[model samples]
Target chain A: MASFKQIHKEFVAALLVPSAPIPKGLVALKKPNITSRFAVYRNNVIVGLIAALKSNFPICFALVGDEFFKALAVDFIRKNPPTSPMLFEYGDEFAFFISQYSPADQLPYLADIARLEIMWRNAYHAIDAKPLDIAKIQQIDAKEHSNLTFKTHPSAAILKSNWPIYSIWQGHEDNDMVDIDLEVKQAILICRPNVDVLIANIDPAACIFYSAIMNGRTLGNAYEKAIKQDQNFDFNYCFGQLFALGLITDIAAEN
Target chain B: MSNFRLKKIPNLAGVGLKAQHYKTILQEKPKLGWFEVHPENYMGAGGPPHKYLTAIRELYPISLHGVGMSLGGPSERLDPEHLRLFKALKDRYEPWLISEHLAWSTHEGKFFNDLLPLPYTEETLNHLANHVDEMQSYMGKQVLIENPSAYLAYESSPYAETEFLDQLVKRTGCGLLLDVNNIFVSANNQGYDAYDYLDAYPVEHVEEIHLGGHSVELIEDDDLGIGKLLIDDHSSAVIDDVWDIYKKLIAKTGPKPSLIEWDGDIPEWPVLFNEAKIADGFMKKHVSTKVKS
Candidate 1:
């Protein structure tokens, strides 16, 4: 028999690569060849990880349907198996994998949908933070509003996409996306104020505004960017939505 | 950590906790011995998993059953980061009992996410002993090591599976989990007698027992030949054969904390709770008869 390390190296190598011969010295009772037996472990790894991916990216699985999703997932699993034992931490790059996958090219919005799903999952599992109280906004003086920089909640995220990711995801979610134009661009917000994660479509300008706030820009700066992007950018409404949802954790005046 | 009071899990049947059943378990607060969870599932920073687990923990004694520790891997030592996370979870949850598998899922920095088998050689035993010892010391308590269900045996393995587990207990002073279904699955898959394996197992050191279901698969290979393989899928109800063996073991050893594990194709809460109730029935029947006798 080979050394313990050598056996593991060979065993793991075979487990990952389907074509890799069964590691030496593996045997089933009364049978010299153990490929069928050994394939159980192989199948378990592939199938188990694929199941984890399926649970993690339900939208992608639903959008592409089962067969395509499984093929796509298998390819992704072969390339980027989980580095950690925590299955939730697996498949962060799955959306990128879908973007590169050729078959999913026909459904161009698929990758962004994957991104939305990832965001929703992240928001669901992200660290809990106490959302800023609505009264805190009332405490802020109008004169200091320009210097006000906002802190986003731990579970807050903004996704901007060329495809109608929000409608596509919401349609699948509610199962009623009426004649969504694939050419339309969409921006989405994912936030968990308390227990449930909330996903909703947001204005493109609000996307830029939220992005700027998350990047530590002052309220004045974020509003300027949002207004420049679209004159109709309603700072009042965006700020109200952010405050209501508890997406903003803190507001500070930049001296 | 030592100052924290460890609530002993009762000698009744428990079920593996699932996220889907959190609301029901919380609202209903069903009569159960305890609940078990994979520590890996709760390793997330914060979320519904933690929230629900916290609420449930207040109601029942929860045991941390880890599947990712790779205690039997050939690494020179266990993964320190994984150990740290395990320690953190143990601290936060303060579970009454903790257990890990005898299989290796991690090798060379990549996790396969499956409990892969190991060859039971002297060298492998020594490595596993060290890993178990390291885990016990890190956790400041005895951790239970479960026997793996095997599909293939190593040609070079010199030690019988029971002998290997017994030696591990003697070497590290850790306890055994005594997975009854795994014993049945492995015995059938490897052409050994489950009864004989049970007789040989170090049941005195067993702190817990796991009763779970397994699926049967037909392996069709022109080269390897045809055979019926039992996969420890844990998706269905526990077979009567497995239950009989479980009864036999408990009949001899008295009642131990047995968990009904159903990880795949999870059924409704009632189905899972009823499985636990069945195991509870076995525990009651055997232990009462033993006492009466």
Candidate 2:
């Protein structure tokens, strides 16, 4: 008789990887063969994990359809089982999965869409915080304003995708936008300063600036990054838009 | 958790809350005992899940049923991160009841996402009791451990299913959430009488009851396929046999807080409520008022 630890080790292997026999001493079912009965547990675990993936990656599921997505989910789950009890926490690496998956290579943008969805979920569950208003920005010391590095809201995410990820996600979510111009760069901004998960398609240059600022660069350096991305980058317009959208929550001025 | 109890639940039939019915439930606010949620679903920071749950929780007494605690995890330890989230939720919600499965869903570093079975032995029982005690102490509230539906039983098992639960209850002071459908399904798969198992059940320790649907599969090898295999999928309406078993227990124990769990192929609000009404019909038939509430 295998110890409980050995049985679990073997059982988990059978559940994930193929070709391992069920652990020993399973009560002999005279009628139903142990293989078929045991498959129920196998089926249940796989099906449940797949469902969690499906829930987290609905847009990916919709793009690929049911059968294809289920197969993809099964493959992903075997390689990357969840480490947390929270089902929502599963599938964090799915976007990368799609990127490397040979079958999904045809749709390169599929991975970015998964990234966007996961970010949306992150924003949805982010810690509740009051975003910085115009008053707080105006209160900054005038001399140190240029050295300000903004603190990102816990729910804020700035995704810079060369692929038109925003339009692709928007098309499926709201509009039936099928024939999108793939050449157009979609710099997407996601934030939940309040209850709703907000998504915006911002200028690529502004996203570069926002990313730098969120990454702890001073406003001066961030502006340079933005200008490098787009020489025509409008600092006032972009910063105004970001502040108005509540993406820039807290600002720290450097000495 | 607050030392002050919020409110008490009636020994009435309730249905597991699904997000699809959120709008209908908020608008209708139907007559139900209380709502139960897999706390994992709302583990996210803030969003529609919390919003809708808050709306419903305001109108009804909520119960938090954890699916991923892996209380009986092979490591014989609970995940600190999971425990932190569970504790945070317990503080915020102060639900009428908090519960987890007797089964383990994790091993080593990987989580399986299903209620995996455990061996019946002194070592296993001691570990489980310690885990349950830690969980209850951490939460500062009585936690109910649920009986799981087993696909196969181990031959090395020393104690009967009911006796194991009884001993665990005595050791940890944790109450039992007797899942009637699990009893029926496990009894069928293990070749035992569901009624007899319920009769031997520690009725005094049962805090809640669960009724769900199970389907039987023909033994693949049998040429006649006369041999049956029961699968507790929790899909569709609760069947007559499970209902009968539930009634038999209720007759002996009187009214207890019961829930109808239809996780698979979840139906609309009316269909689910109707299932609860069926369980309610059984509850009304057997016992009049609450006894072991």
Candidate 3:
């Protein structure tokens, strides 16, 4: 007789690994056919997990087609089942898995696309915060602004990749861009200032500054890093773009 | 305990509130008893789920059905984090009724999100009862434990499924949610008396009823195409057999709050709304029959 703990371990093992036989002592003695019946449980588990991934990564699903995507998702699920019940946070590691996935290597840019989708989901579900009043930033004296530190929106993220992921993302939205220039590098600033999630293409300098503030660095230090990344980095232009997007929710200045 | 007596739900039928149907539900204001949502769907930070749910909730009563609680987890401790999320949703919505499956979806720090059946044994019964008791207490309200649609029965199980549920009721003072579709599907797959399972059920304590669709698949290479298995895929309209069983249960137990659940391949608003109306029609017919008798 299997203990509850033992049975669950075996059952989960059997569920994830399709080739593994059903857990011992799980067969119905009265019923003649148990394997096919057991397969139903496997089908339900795999199908349900696949559906979650499919919804999360529609672009990936479309690019790979349904059959290939299901197979890919099944492999990922077998390796990494969810730790928490909240499914919105379930696929955070999927993009990482896709990057390392051996079979998906042919389409090198597929993993970055998955990353963008995950970022969109994160922004969609992040804590709602009121964007800082623009008037306050407008009134900041020249010297005071230099030492100021700002807190980025709870859901703000910067995804920098060598592939043109934004164009790939746009192609999926029915505005099909026939030819994607994959050689060019791209960086997207993801934020949900209001109801709709917003994404803006930014330069490497802006990515450097965004990463600095997200790491709780002072504006003065972030500007130094941004300038180091790009000699032509315009603090005013980058700041203006971020302010317009409502990516910065709060700020503090050392008087 | 909000009275162990069943909570009085409107004697009308309802449907699972899906996001696609939100706009039309608010615009048309479909005649629904109450709309149910999986609390997990609303757990997101902000946006449309709140916007439309707020509008629709005002017009119709709401019920919270949970899919990820892991009530009967192998570990003694209930997942505190999930409970916290659940508590927040309950405080916000104040749904008419909240229910979770009797089975566990999480174990050993991993979750499957599918309702996995349990062996009917004394150890399993006691563990589940304690979990339910703790859950109801933590929620500051009683919860109805829904019986799962079983795929395979354990031969080593000492107690019958009904007896195990009855024990939980006796020990923890929780209510039951009878999924009629589940009953039919499980009976057909496991080769049991569907009505007999219902007869042995604690129907008096059944606070709610659920009706959904299922598909039949023939098992291969077993006694030369000897058996058929029914999968409870809630994607299609309610089948005739499930309707017959639901009507029989309604006739026996009288009218209760029923929900038309079309989880997958959800049809347009009118079709799903009509299914709810059909359920309501059955309830009205049962009432008229009682008056004639």
Candidate 4:
């Protein structure tokens, strides 16, 4: 009799790698057709996992065509099986895997694109929060603004990329034919003001400021960092832009 | 609210609610007896999933159908994180039923993301029953154990699948979800008689049922040349053969709260509702007539 742990381990191993040896007690219906039944399970498991990944990373699939994406997915699944039962969270390490994947090394920006897609998925499913009311912020005194620590909204994502990922993503959207340029760097911000996801280009200074806020920096310190990066960093314009996008939700007193 | 505490779900048909049809269903308030959701989808802290679920719960009964519990495993241990989230959702939604698959999903701490089958044996049954008992104790309510749509069977199983399920329910006092499509798929895959399996099932313990579509694939075999394999893809329309079997099972078991599951490539809301309506019409015609006579 196989222990529960041994049986489960063997079952999963058989499902993951079809060629893995089945446990001692497991039987073949006839003489030498040992791998027959296990092959069915192995196909189902791999196909299901790949389908889940494709659903979660549709944009990633679009970037890399289906054949290449599926091949990469098979390797990725074998290397990094899911840590959690929640399928929505199964591909957390996919971007990291893509980074080290040698076959995909020709597309240096593929990993970052995967990261962007993951962020979009995260923002889509993040906890819902009411964006800061513009009228409420206007009610506060201008003098107290520097002392206030602004908290970013739950649906806010700030990303910086050396490739024109926004164009690549948008081109894929309408099935538009556009040549990919290898020399463009883009900083993008994605926010959910209401229900629709809105993506926009952001300046490097504002990206730094938002990134700082995302990392728990005080508003004044983030502003200082933003200005240090770019001498002509428009604090008022960037602040208004962030507020308009509903990225700032909570405000705390700077200690 | 009525004081009637249902020991078993009434034999009425229901629909699996999707986000695309949330507003339409809520606004129209269709005469659905119940709704089922995959608990993992709503495991987040606060979001639209919960919001829509809250609104829907006020109108109809709900069932938290879990897909990731890995109930049929070697160890009798339940995932604490999954349990906590499920408990929280149950508390907030106050669903009428909770259920999970009779299959394992994880091994060595790595989730395979599919409901892998288990060999039916005394050891596996004991392990699964204890897990079911633990889950019921933690949730403070009985759960329905649904039969999985398996693609293959292990050659080393000592007990029949139905017998394993019977032992599980006997030990844990848990009910059965009795997915008829799954029975069809598994029977076809394993070259067993689906009708005989259904007839032998402990129908009294069944509280709910599931009906879904499956896709067939032809695999080459050395001796058999090509063999037909039924895959429970849940991506297309329900087949006539499965529906016929479902009607026969319903006739025998009486009306149970059944659900029409179309998970992948889900069609327009009306198409799914029409399918539900078909099942609803059958239940009303058969079960209600039996009650009246």
Candidate 5:
């Protein structure tokens, strides 16, 4: 006489843990043997969640190959079953998980690759907004340019990584054979300025500047932060890229 | 709430819309009765999924078949966040038919992503009926609940699957989406006659029908009485035995809107489209034969 709650608790417990025995009260029609039958659900739960994870982190899957990815993904799925029902939102913590996973320490950059993929996915589905045209910025008085604050597009994001993640991601995207320099620190700007998601490599200085503006810093303050990182940081280059990519949706001059 | 008009999807064969097929569907505008999508897929704020869905919605009718509602969950109530997102999709798309499974996918705030089975008991019935009622009340329209494909049965269950569903419908005033392949798969796995399950089903309340393919695996132990277990993978074409059951169902229910759902190992657009045509042929043949009678 298991209560519904008790039965469901047992059911879900076994579902997440592959080695757990079948919960009590489950029966098959023909014979008492329900092991294989129950195993179907265990397989479905694990396999289905693994599939969702695979779709979410395709680059991570590609880097590790199928076997390692499946094993790693299974561990991740069992440990961190999705809190949300939306499959697309399932693996937000996967990048963080990969960073701590010991087996993947050999490929230290794999976690950052997962992060870039997540960023691309987020950009793909981010809230749509009209990109601010250059004409809008041209109207801003030169004296007010440095004092102007910018509103980043909803989909815009900056990722700075110790590994050459942009090159690895680009190689996968273009299906090209490129010798990635592992020592090179890389930063990328990810956004959906229009219909398609765009991911471009950005200078480290620009990453700091973009991060500052995205954090609601004024142009002067963002530029100051960028120059602090690199004495030769080019403000015009950073501002040109932002305006060309339409990453800024609105700008407000300080009163 | 009163002015909401649930668009009527034509009673013809449709295909489960996949993202890969979106471009082809928009370009070809194939003569599909309607397109069906899992509302969870479109829950994102805005993107290609929405862009293509919007374009296709203009040319063809759409139905939202939810896979993550957790309507029969053990929790006290349905997930409010999921409900809000689903409601937004329904408002934006205005799908002709909205449906979810009788099984639960969430427990203790973790989503399993599979339509896990529930036991059939008076308490279970009451719980499911309340969930359904809440969904309908919030939706301002009836949602057809689909029967889940099962592999194992609960020993403590008191009622048959169909009887439980009938009770849920009677209490909640919701409709049913009969997935014929689920019947074949569940019956074969659970040792019940597919035709018998169909016979016991409350077909009068069925508003739409689903047709899909399943994968079969042979169990190692013959003494278990279950020689082959059918998995409703929906990765291939509908088999003849399932079609026979579907024909039998349509003969009784008379040409409900059926969909050819190939969710896994999806083939080329034409291959999936051809499967829908096959279903359309069955619906037409059954209807004409009934007209003759």
Candidate 6:
């Protein structure tokens, strides 16, 4: 009788790699063809995992097309099987995997596009938070403005990329008519107003400002850094846009 | 009155709640007996998943069906994070029943994202039963263990599938979800008698049931195409054969909360609800017969 550990190892190995030789211990007298039988099970296992990945990363699959993506997914699954049983939570490092993959390297922006998809997914699933009320903003004294710390909405995401990720994503969307240019650099803000996740482009200065706020910087310091990056940085326009987008959810004076 | 009282799930038919129908289900307030969601989908702190689930919970009983527990693994250690999330979900939703699959999904800390089959033996049963006991203890509630739909079975299993299930329930006091489609799929794949398997099942421990659609693939060997056997793909409409088996099981087990699950290639709301309606009709018929008798 094979030991339980040996049989399990063999079973998992067989599920991942069909051609791998089954560990010597897992033998049953009636069914000597354990190899072929397990192969069928292995196929089902891979197919299921691949389908889950496809669902979780539909835009990534759409970019590469099904045939190539499925092949790539098979490779990705073998290399990095999920760390959690929840299929939705699987593929955390898929974008990073595409970044390092040789075949995917030619599409230099694929990784960033994958990141945008991840951000959209995160925004879609992030916790609901009440947007900053204009009434609350009126309560802050002009003297305390410099000491006020702004907190980004729980669902706020800032993504910067050289490629037009928003256009790329919109181009592949169902019933979308926008033409996409793969070469243009794009900076995007993804946030949820109500239940709908909205993605919009912003200048690099605003991206930096929001990134600083997200990193727990005070509004005054964030503005100073934005001004340093771009002398023409329009604080009024940027702040107004952020507020209008419902990005800032909480404000506190630095203690 | 304590609002946290464990609401007993009605012995009627329900449907797996999906994001696509969240608004409609909440707004229309369909008369669903219960709703089941994959707990992992709502593991995040605050999100649409939680918001919708909270709204829906007020109207119908909920069950947390976990897909990631990997109970059949050789290791004695269960994932603490998974346990924490399950605890959080239970606290938030106060689900009527919590359940996991009878298969292992992870090994050596890597999840395959599929419910892999287990060899039914003394060692395997002991490993799984211990995990079930641990999960029950951690959650402070009994869990329903569902049978996995396997494409192949290992010859090493000494115990029959039903017997293995019976022993697990006996050892852990856990209930069974008794997925009828999984029974049909496994029996077809292993060339076992499906009805005999059902007949041998300990129906008293079955707390809920699942009915789902499957796809059939024809196997060819030596230039001969054999009769088709089904695979539990959860991608199609529930077939007549599976429904027939479901009717039989409901007739025997009496009315229990049944869920119409269509996870892949999901149809429109009405089509999916029609499937639930079929199961609901059967449950109602059983109820009327019981009262008449």
Docking class of 4: acceptable
The DockQ score of candidate 4 comes to: 0.43
Off by over 4 Å in 3: A24-30, A133-149, A175-177, A212-237, B1-9, B221-224
Every model: Cα RMSD to truth: 2.0, 3.2, 3.4, 3.2, 2.1, 2.8
Please give the C-alpha DockQ score of model 3: 0.51
As a whole number from 0 to 100, the lDDT of residue A187 in candidate 3 is 86
lDDT tens readout by residue for model 6, B121-218: 89998888899999999999999999888756666789988899999999999999999999888787666778998999988889999999988876
- Expressed as tens digits, the lDDT of each residue in B94-199 for candidate 3 is 7788899988888788989788878888888889888898889998877888888877777678988787888888999888888999998888777788999988
> Model 3, residue A166: displacement in angstroms?
1.5
Measured by C-alpha RMSD in angstroms, how accurate is candidate 3?
3.4
lDDT of 3 by residue, A116-221 (tens): 9999998888878888876887787867777888878988899998898878887887758589897878989899888778888888898898889778888889
DockQ scores for all predicted structures: 0.68, 0.58, 0.51, 0.43, 0.73, 0.47
Q: Scoring only chain A, what TM-score does candidate 2 earn?
A: 0.88
For model 4, how does the per-residue alpha-carbon lDDT over A82-152 read when each residue is reduced to its tens digit? 87777776788899999999989898888888888888777766787888776766788877666667777
Candidate 5, which CAPRI tier?
medium
User: Candidate order by DockQ, highest to lowest?
Assistant: 5, 1, 2, 3, 6, 4
Maximum-DockQ candidate? 5
| TM-score, cand. 1 vs. native | 0.96
Candidate 5 per-residue lDDT, tens place, B1-293, comes to 31234557888998999999988988898988888999989999987888888888888888999999898899998999999989988888888889999999999899988998888999999999999998989887899999999998888888999999898888999999999999999888877899999999999999999999898897854466438888989999999998999989988888889999999998999999998898899889987887899
Report the C-alpha displacement of residue B67, candidate 6, in angstroms.
1.6
For candidate 5, write residues A1-255 as lDDT tens digits: 888899889998888776887898887674645778788898998899899999998878888899999989988988899988788878889999999999999999999999998898999899888888988778878888888898889999889899998899988888763688889889899989878888889887888898988998999899999999999998888788887777899875474
Error of 5 at B61 (Å): 1.7
Q: Write the per-residue lDDT of candidate 2 for residues B1-293, one digit (tens) a residue.
A: 54334756679888899989999999998999988899988888876787788788788887899998887777867787788888888787778899999898988878888888888877788888988998998888999999999978777889877899999999989999999999988888877888889889898998899999988787755433557778888887888888888888888778888999989899988999998888888788665445335
**Residue A18 Cα positional deviation in candidate 3, in Å, after optimal superposition:** 2.5
What TM-score do all the candidates reach, one by one? 0.96, 0.91, 0.91, 0.91, 0.96, 0.92
* Number of the candidate with higher lDDT, 3 or 6: 3
In model 1, which regions exceed 4 Å deviation?
Answer: B1-5, B220-226
Error of 6 at B13 (Å): 0.4
